[model samples]
Target: MVETGRIRVAKDKADLVKSLISTDGATGPFQTFADAIAFAAALGAKHNRRVPLGEISKREPSPIRLEYFASMGHDCVIKLLAITETKDIKILSLTEESEAKRNLIFEEYANGGLEILQNELRGAVDYSERILLMLCPEREQQEQQNEEFDLSKFLS
Candidate 1:
């Protein structure tokens, strides 16, 4: 039961990481890649373990990942990278986007114009998951795309 509890906690942590990564739109600017990394690191640290940054760095992450990270927030990305290096975890470049572009993304996310804020919250969760995978290339898995970006399908 103790081991099961630990496993459950780890799974929850992983899910939280996924959510942080894929969140999108204007609840605020999408979390920067740095934020995502820090969140992940904190989660690991809380468990008294460190992420395998050295191993992750050795693998080349996809360009989309670099662009996404850069877009989320460049400064955060740099800090995360430095931390990863110090921790001997592998670091990979993901998506890189400018502040302007990232704000535009938030604008689009707010498009329902406040009428559908509740509905938008659900979408935001899905977006967070997608973004997380985008930053952590090693976590990418081959899954079928849903029709019209269907959240039910993706989340299911």
Candidate 2:
């Protein structure tokens, strides 16, 4: 892990991060930019969307640090994403190159997820409620799927 370095958000999505984080008296759903990024990365991975950051998109106002991710226990998410993307556990090797690869995968997924969120949150009155509304359907569908796959009941 690159302990001393920062994790960056795409320049295009920086404003979106600000809108979603709770710092500076913002009423966003997440308490910190790292939280939002982790959520976005998961969202993007769920949708299988990974958008690489262009030269123009990787700029100033980089959000969280590598240490913050480890401290907050989000490093597991990074490792999971990296391993899933490469389909090899070796991607989790403790080396600078491996860490860079992990961060790149994370950043791209986050960018894609942020794009989805931007469209979803546009013109919303409250971000927290909007996020909850987004999650409800997914949970319902998952529950329905679970009920459909209850094979023990069928056996009985």
Candidate 2: regions farther than 4 A off: 1-4, 55-60, 150-156
Model 1's TM-score against the true structure = 0.24
Candidate 2 residue lDDT tens string, 113-133: 988899999999799999999
Weakest ten-residue segment in model 2 by summed lDDT: 54-63
TM-scores, all models, native as reference? 0.24, 0.88
Model 1, position 139, has a per-residue lDDT of 36
Predictions in order: lDDT: 0.33, 0.83
Candidate 1 residue lDDT tens string, 1-156? 111100011221233333444345333323543444434333333333432211112121111233444455543534443444345333222323233233222222222222122233355545545435444643343233334466775564
Q: Which candidate achieves the best TM-score against the true structure?
A: 2
Instruction: Candidate 1: list runs displaced more than 4 Å.
Output: 1-14, 19-35, 42-48, 53-64, 74-156
Note each model's CA RMSD in angstroms: 19.7, 3.0
